[model samples]
Target: MTHRLALLLLLIWSTPLRAAQEDPASAALAAMHQLEAATVALEEAESARDRVRAYTNTIRAYETGLAAMREGLRRAATREVELTRRLSAQEGELAQLLGVLLTIETAPTPVLMLHPTGALGSARSGMMLADVTPELQARAAAMRQNLEEVQTLRLLQKNAVRTLNDAMASMQQARAGLSMAIADRTGLPSRFTEDPVRTAILIASTETLAGFASGLSEIASGDIAGMMASISDQKGSIDLPVQGAVLHGAGKADAAGIARDGILVATRPRALVTAPTAATIRYLGPLLDLGNVVILEPQPDTLFVLSGLAEVFGKVGEVVPAGTPIGLMGGEAPQIGAFLSLSGEGNGPERSETLYIEVREGDSPVDPETWFRTDKDG
Candidate 1:
């Protein structure tokens, strides 16, 4: 048992340590530090010259930090289980080692050295004990290290509850600040204002998404200005307006067998949706069966239709900059206890909201995936 345990301990101890994956407790600690910075930034957002931009950035930071914390916690939990399983496997051998330590600790040195086989036997036993004593000590020390780590991980997880709660509270504050800032924001140029009467008439006349999109070109009440920067060079590299997984690509049929000319993205609840490029807001509001729609005219003829927003920002005619906050995906934010439960059970955030995206170039449906970067992310 001692030989086997010693070999196992040596194998584990000699394995080269790589820093590719950071220590879990350290990662969680780093995430806590990041959350603290985000909280500080949120406090300063009210006085920022561009409050909208400041709040937007702060919210993004919180989202990132929280995600990191989730990841770090998951890793810690997994590693803790692994260390525990290994230590438990050697419990029997360790119990015997505990007995040896206690024997020497309680008995005098002379009594421990005496052997039933007399002087030479005692000498041989002493030498053998000396050799194995260091191995036993090393095994106990290895077990101690693992025990300490498991205890540390358990304590970190226990304390993570407060950290997560505080981070979530600060995120809510950031979101509120962002909403207020957007309300006070101004100075965005308008290409053409929406004529209420014409838009109303068009909405009543059109039953399909394609027809409504086609009618937008003729419904604007004012003169259309020159187009924004051409994104023709940026094909296949534009960032997705929101962080999500593409549920259905263009023309992909749903369970009902109805295929749409857009991609459906599955996003986590209340995830921020930003403008992918510098574009003029053509229209925003509920339309037909779509819950909420925001149409963007990036160029003269090209339009990007984003549907299913809980709350849309910016006016129909205002030209917003790229990466500006446009809207938020719907669904209630998870409560702290529920979030912790999810962190314990899930691999990542639960995507409970869906966003519909369609791209039209000169009244013709085009593949949005061709223009936007769809690379995988954590």
Candidate 2:
């Protein structure tokens, strides 16, 4: 009994340590480390940290950390449920085994060795038990391992909510800082001066998205001397403007049976949207049925139209570099209960807000998947 107990303890200690190392919780810890590092650096820099670039990175760190934690918690919960199911399925066998082990534990070694039969029969029975020792040890080790894992995963989830709350607070601060920084931004070269009268006239006259897009150049005060470098070579390599799930591909119909020329991405509440490359903003305002739109002219006769933003940033003629924050998707952040309940079903991307993306060349709308790097590329 003593030897078996020692073996069980040894296996439990070794296996859980290794399992904990490779578990989903490690990802959350890694992300938390990154967030802590970014925030610490931002604090140490003080004045230097109050820039769009710094704030963007900090916001990203917070998002990554929070997402990792949420995913970890969900996976932990699922794993715990599975382990419990497995243990329950084997409950009867486990109970009988435990009873036998307990009986053996309480008995003296001399009595256990003695049997009702003669000495030869007793020796034979002891040899049979000896033959089965390894199997019993293995079963005990497996049960112990499962029990320990369930305990560990539960502890990870129990502590994660508080950490997530703190991270969410820091993320909001980063976003606010970025908003203020964008408001105070300067020195970005302009491709052309904006003509509000022509823009307003175009808006009032246009009835369709194509019509508005075709006449967007009229809002500019004539063509500027220089344009940003052509991005023709970078097609299919551009980063996605926002982190979200793709609800529908270009030309893919929704449940309502309506199809559009652009891809629909469902973003999280208040998710950041950015420019995929260097481009001149040609138009940024409400247009037709779409919400706030930011039109970018990356080259001659080419347009990248991003719509459905809660708030637009920059003027109509400013040139924004790659990955510059352009706008934000609208919606309120989730409460703790709602967040845990809604997030991490392993279903798909967060769908709190939706962004519509369209890429037009010459005069016709094309598939956005042709231009952006997607998960499929991986």
Candidate 3:
């Protein structure tokens, strides 16, 4: 009976001893330590901006380390179960031995205590068996606790891996987009503003020139209707009126024609014409105070024209689009003109120089200011 008890004790004691030797918790503990250290390094690198690559590398390293740790824990768990089964068998055997020893003690013929050595050995053996049960249970609990902790850590590590990968991708894409924006310098002039201006000129108006002449004829008597008749009514190219180039000095515009000498010889920049969508003045001429003028009729009722350039694009009956650069300021020097026409008064001096840009819905000239976007501020 004593021998059997001694064997049981050995088995129970060895179960925990074997676990201690293996140190099942060591793998999980080491993994956590590595994770902790790596996380700290990652944060530091992110703060410095100098170690982003290293930080990414460390994150991947953490994943590899964690995976290895989990594998170790799985192996340890298997060992733990084997140890637990051994412990159970040893415990059952020990219980049976103890029952046998108690039965001998309770016999009516009081059994004499065995020799000191034998009794001491039996007592020591029983104590050993008893001590190993709690120790084994405690150690098993500790190992299981460590296993659970490792499982939790595995979950956390997985989340961390995903989050870091997403962050890296986002950062890379942001950098690429910034690079693209820097490459395109949109809407800027091709040449420097300091470059000398260039221009082209085309003369097309006959009625405008005649009206200009009629306005200039202050000598015409009352109403001046009969005098205008002598200018001819031919609408064709036949009997084309002679064209004149008059150079005047800088001046202002009011009611009677270009004030004195307001015309300055200019080279004026080219005009860009776009398709029309609204009513606008199709063409204007003779670089006036504003410059050579041309109106774009995008709609039937609206007339839009610029009057500060020496050149105009598109002629009568020509269609232009919206927002086309119709004309630009062009001049070797500044120049100006005026468009004035009298109403009830017969070529009155007060009404001859007052140039008006009007919008006509049907037959009337409306204020042009309502629709014009002036470069005054531009």
Q: Highest lDDT: which candidate?
A: 1
TM-score of each: 0.87, 0.88, 0.24
The global C-alpha lDDT for each of the candidates, from Candidate 1 onward, is: 0.81, 0.75, 0.35
lDDT, candidate 1, residue 88?
92
Residue 202 Cα positional deviation in candidate 2, in Å, after optimal superposition: 1.0
Model 1: per-residue lDDT, tens digit, 309-342? 9999988888999889999889998887777666
lDDT assessment of candidate 2 = 0.75
For model 2, the run of ten residues with the poorest summed lDDT: 1-10
TM accuracy, model 2: 0.88
Q: Candidate 1: lDDT of 124? A: 97
lDDT of 1 at 356: 91
Tens digits of per-residue lDDT for model 2, 1-378: 133333332332233234445566665445445445545534432355337765665565555555555665666667878999999999999998888777766878888688888798889988987777667778988999999888877777666677667767777777887888889889888888988999999999999999999987788787775774799999898888887767889999966799999998878888888888888898898988899999998888899999999988888889988878889889987777766665447554346688999999999999998998776410
**Model 3, range 1-378, lDDT digits (tens) per residue?**
133333332332233323434454554444434444444444443443323223333333343333333433444445555656665556665566556555645755423433357879767765775676566556556655655655654554444444444433433332232233223313321111111111111222224422322222232223312111111121111110001111232244434555532232222122112222322233445533444555544443333333454344333333333332233333221111110011112122221111123333344343332333222210
Per-prediction CA RMSD (Å): 9.7, 9.0, 35.2
Residue 59 lDDT, candidate 1, scale 0-100: 75
User: Which residue segments of model 1 deviate by more than 4 Å?
Assistant: 1-20, 104-107, 111-127, 255-257
Q: Using TM-score, rank the candidates from best to worst.
A: 2, 1, 3
Error of 3 at 1 (Å): 69
